[model samples]
Target: MARSGIQYADVQQAIDALLTRGDAPSVQRIREVLGTGSFTTISEHFRHWRNEREQNRDVPPPKGVPEAVATLATDMWRQAQEVANEGLVHYREEANRKVEAAQDEVLQATREAGDAAQRECALAEHLHHREERMEALGAQLADSQAQQSALLARCNNAEQDSAAWAKDVGRLKTRLEQQTSEHAQQRETERGLFGQQLGEEQQRNEATEGKLLALLDSVRQERADDDKAQRKRTQQLQARLESASEEGRESRRELKAAEETQAQWQRRYEQAENEARAQHETVLQHRREAEALHERLLRAERTLDAEREQRIQEADWQVSLSQRLDALQQQVATLPATAPENDDDKPAEDHSDSPPKT
Candidate 1:
């Protein structure tokens, strides 16, 4: 019972028995008769049984009925025939027994009548009672025949019901097998679809992971290139700054040297100016001495003429002294101008060492 839940075969047998008794099987009554069954399980199978019955209900009974139903019907008819024959035998035996009893009474009456003529009237009365008894036995035999006919009709109806039920059970078994095959086919199709979808999703995830790694490498390369460019630009700017700083220091040194040289030239100009003034004073004194000497010569010439022959040798000495004085005056005039010209020539030599302009 546990291995097999209530099946259509169980329900079919139960329906056949109920149908033979002319009672319709219901869910509640089938459970009660089986003694161990789920109401829902019984109800389901019962529905299937009813469907089969409806399909075959209108069909006519077949001539070649199953052997089991035919055998059962044949046995019932044979039993009815045997019972009727036995009843007929009992009726004939009872009639014969009554007829023998009446004959024995008639024999006794004939013997008694011969013994006495006065007893003949009593014998006639006994014959009338025997006729009444015969009529009662005949009525009982007619009732027995009527009961045998009714039994034959019930047996015929039972055979028809059993044949109809067998056809219904056969149709239900075929339908159940078809439904089971279709359900198995549908399950296989759904399983295949699920596996295909899972494989596609896995492939998509792998492709996405590869793309993410490529994007990361590209970003790192761009960052390295930017850093290299920044360092190169910084190096160029540093070089330019150092070059400009060296040029600035050199310019400062040149400016200091130029300022020192200008101060030295200014001192030299003051000293040259003082020497020119002193030279001018010395030239004036020399001119005065020459003028005094010229006047004395003129006095000397006049005296010579008075005593020419008295001092001829002294006159020749005075002429020589005048010639030497004129030559000394010419030398003093040229020397003073030429000294300042020599002082101007010294600055040109010093200027050559000074730095060029910025």
Candidate 2:
């Protein structure tokens, strides 16, 4: 960088000022006099000024001046210029020493600045490496967090499934309990109905027996009177007696059929009782099955297809039972009422074979 604005005229003016003050003009002195100019600018201008002064110095003295006087004045002026030159030399030495010291300071400052720059560069590189490491760590942390979030979501889903499974188990258990209680009640009701029907049948059979016996005795008495009172009516009396015997035989057969029906009913009652006991055992088995179901709930999802088929089969079986019950009821409804002896013609419908569908 060079200082600007210093012209030849400015340098020349400064040099003349120095001469008027009786000081030797040098580049440093002219620069000092001007107070603001570059050494190169002042030196170039001073060179030109010295060339002009040299050319003018060889010119003759003024027209009025004598040769001897002018020569003495020139000697004296040369001697004074020599003295000023000596002082300029001393000033230049001092200026050189100060300039050297300034240069040393500039060199020292440059070295310190270079050291600071090196330290700053090293720090910037270290910071860059640190930032890269931080970025890598942050990426790893993000991956870990994503994995953890996935695991947590899976855990939450598993927890929800477990809760629903537990609720289903409790619900099934409650339903089983209710069904068991109802089955027991149904069994007892059927038992009581069967017992009542059995008693009623027995009573009806006994009453029919007594009425047949009385009719037989009355016929016997009429036959004796007919035979004893009139010989003419003997054939008719014999026919009437034969008819009474046939009626007794028919009545006896009906009584035997009634007894057979009673025995059949008794057997059915026992069978019903057995079936009820079996049903109770089935309930216990169902309890065991429920326990097994609870133990195997984890397998529930796997068995869904198979269980769907099972449920379909069970539904069909229930439908069949319903149809059978309906048919049996219609049969009973269509059966005609008969004499007390033949009252047991309608067979007691046994429905204890199959448990009721839930």
Candidate 3:
């Protein structure tokens, strides 16, 4: 009685046609036409229809039963009951077959549904795991970003410190250069003074040689005059000889004194020359020390410059790292919540392959 739609009417007609043919249609065919796999459902509907028809037959005719036709109605009722019983038996057999087929179909559908549900559950679990992995990667990326920021700050400070050290080194180099120049000038002055003193000593030695030569000529002239005066006065010859001998002795002593004075001057000159040489050597040693100091300062300045450049390079690297971190952060921010799928309902590993933060 609940069968009220066109689809239900069509199914009832199909059932009647199958019954009339004395061969019930296969459940597959019914399912193909009815778009349902349940044989029990089909059998139940047929049972309900047969029961409704039988109930109608069992009901008494509406106010038309007469005694004269009672015997005839009874005979017709017996034959109708026999025919109904045969039809019911045929319906029952068909219902059993349909029920078996429907049960098989339901079981198959249930298995398929179960398999599908299992697959879906597996996929959902896999997606959940992937989401957790992505979340962990994002957290790691955030931590790396934080480290990069701190490193960048430290690098910037190092660069500033290097620049200051470079400036200080530059000032120190300038002062060292000035000191070196003054030392060089002093050495030149010392050399010039030494040369002038040597020239003055040489001139004094030449004048002393000229005075000794004149004194030797005067002694020769006096000896000749003494010989002539002794020949002229025989009586006073002895006295003159005595006087001449005293004069000769005095001249020899004077000559010895002059020679000793000249030797002293020579010794003094040699000492002065040796002192000058020693002073020159000392000055040269000082100059070498100054030069060495200057070289050391230059090397130190170069080292400072190299260190400064290295710090600057490090700073640049830190800046680049910060930029990369910023870019990675931006990319993370723009990532979609739901990952896209391909044919297999699996999310691709796009974000996972991204570079490290910074």
Off by over 4 Å in 3: 1-79, 93-102, 200-358
Q: Give the TM-score of candidate 2.
A: 0.38
Candidate 1, after superposition: displacement of residue 74 in Å?
A: 99
The 10-residue segment of model 1 with minimum total lDDT is: 349-358
Model 1 clash count equals 0
Candidate 2, residue 46: the lDDT equals 66
Instruction: Residues 209-323, candidate 2: write the lDDT tens digits.
Output: 5764766677666766644544544455467556655655665565565556556555654564565455456555655555554454435434544555655665565565555
What would the per-residue lDDT of candidate 3 be over residues 1-358, giving only the tens digit for each residue?
Answer: 3333335455566654543433333333444556753554554454454455444544554455465455444444344444545555565566556556556655555565566557556655655665575566556556655655554565555555545655655565565456545545654554465456446545644664465466557766775664465355443545644665565566556556555655655565456456545655655565555556556555655655665565566556556555555554454443332111010111111222211111
Candidate 1 deviant stretches above 4 angstroms: 1-111, 114-149, 197-358
lDDT of 1: 0.48
- lDDT of all the models against the reference? 0.48, 0.55, 0.50
Sorted on lDDT, best first, the list reads 2, 3, 1
Extract clashing residue pairs from model 2: none
TM-scores vs. true structure, each candidate: 0.22, 0.38, 0.35
